[model samples]
Target: MNSSQFEKIKNGKGFIAALDQSGGSTPKALAAYGVLEDAYTNDDEMFDQVHEMRTRIITSPGFDSSHILGTILFEQTMDREIEGKYTADYLADKGIVPFLKVDKGLADQKDGVQLMKPINDLDETLRRANERNIFGTKMRSVIHEANPSGIKAVVEQQFEVAKQIMAADLVPIIEPEVDIHSGEKEKCEDILHDELIQQLNALSENEYVMLKLTIPTKNNAYKELIEHPRVLRVVALSGGYSRDEANEKLKQNDGLIGSFSRALAADLRANHSGEEFDEALKSAVESIYDASVNKH
Candidate 1:
């Protein structure tokens, strides 16, 4: 692990950029960026378009470390280049830590939840990430209900995979998101909070993990997890909330930072001119940054 990068994440004043939209979510991400489905006829073309979007965001003057601590990247994005440097290298140059999304998407929902599918060639992926100067990895699973068994299974699986990532000397962001729209959203978060603490308690004394959770219905709902010695940082995903709504809720949480995807890129459009794009991105980044650093 890079010590300097680790310190930055441990005490950084800004939010993480979730630019890791996967193959399954790329089309929707592109569509929101003003690149409609008709623009890309195949998967490769689709990815190319999304790559361009990512490249634009990474290279923008507005996307720097001053108000952005790190970026979470798709595996494909990590493998690709921005400007003359690899994506991770490019981020490092801007003083930003880069994390790779390592999950192979989610499996079909069972027991009212969805767990991550088996990650094929995970060792190879970790090796590649280390070679590229990547600082960490992020993987996700979802809980749609307050079922104790299902939530327990999700948390266990996340920690299990996270250990493999940690063994590679990279920090892992274990995301067991309780769906923001679940009928029992508060109950789901309460269960998830307990499950997470249990898993954190079981970690070896020297081991550390990061968490990415849905912004809870109640303020400071995961305060214990945020303060755990075993936890390095606790970040909140935007889920389906608009940027404004997400920011409002985020300010009420004292220790959490934003790891927003849709909300971070909400104001940018594919058809925007150079200056327009930069200004829009700057606006988005500034708002999210404020919400991250200025707690209620």
Candidate 2:
């Protein structure tokens, strides 16, 4: 995506609505959405239902005002079409940016931290995403503690992948998410801060990076990182918190927007009246937007 489009997402009042669940999480999400537990057995069955659910959200009457700046989609959802329109086109028509999740998944742990697996046939995937008009991409790796060596390894791998992504002409949301439940929360944030600085320091003077971080243990922990010359915008992920808890923590944060998944989609899913679904979705979006737009 271009700088102007990134600016639109940054400056807008909306947070990214993450519909990017894959694999077992799809069926889990369907169940959470109130689908019967026996509704689907495998990926194919679940994918069709997910497509339907997302389509419902996209076409909902009040979704246009839900303060949603963008959406991050799973590979299956990213590749799907509605009637004659690509899903990306469908969202773009509504003035929402579309981003694709590009990492294959997590790899075996190294230094007690899990890194994202390299994607398969990534060039082909990026080409298809661009062909479908996707604006950007996201990949995730985890940081489990204050271990300097582990954090450095995670940051290096993520930036290596991110450098490749930017080379392909798409904005990359580098997510090196620290586990919130881990101890030494503030210390971990400090380690992450230094590691981020080490990696971002290598970028050319004007390159723009978007980060999707775990909500800081201490408010404004990454303030300097986000203020770096190469960083465009920084957004937080829920990292397994409940919607209410995530919203509460986000309130203490500064200069960061949200790209949350569980919290953003918490109130969305099955069995509600159309009006009920829209209202719940709208409320969730607004709460997230309120937290995200907070200034330092």
lDDT (Cα atoms) of all candidates against the true structure: 0.95, 0.81
How does residue 10 of candidate 1 score in lDDT? 96
Candidate 2 local lDDT, residue 224: 89
Q: What TM-score does structure 1 among the candidates reach? A: 0.99
What is the C-alpha lDDT profile of model 1 across 186-236, one tens digit per residue? Answer: 999998888898889999987899999999899998899999999999999
Q: State the TM-score for model 2.
A: 0.94
- Where does candidate 2 have its weakest 10-residue lDDT segment? 58-67
Worst 10 residues of 1 by lDDT: 190-199
Please estimate how well model 1 matches the true structure, expressed as its whole-model Cα lDDT: 0.95
User: For each candidate, what TM-score against the reference?
Assistant: 0.99, 0.94
lDDT of residue 75 for candidate 2: 79
Per-residue lDDT of 1 in model 2? 62
Candidate RMSDs in Å, in order, are: 0.8, 1.8
Q: Please write out the lDDT profile of model 2 over residues 1-296, one tens digit for every residue.
A: 65656777757776787888887577777777888657877668778888888888777765563477888888788788865788888888888888999888888877757888767688898888888888888988887767889888888888887887788788788888888888866787788888889889899975667889988878888888778878877888999998878878887877777888777667886888888998888788778888877543
* Residue 182 displacement (Å), model 1: 0.7
Off by over 4 Å in 1: none
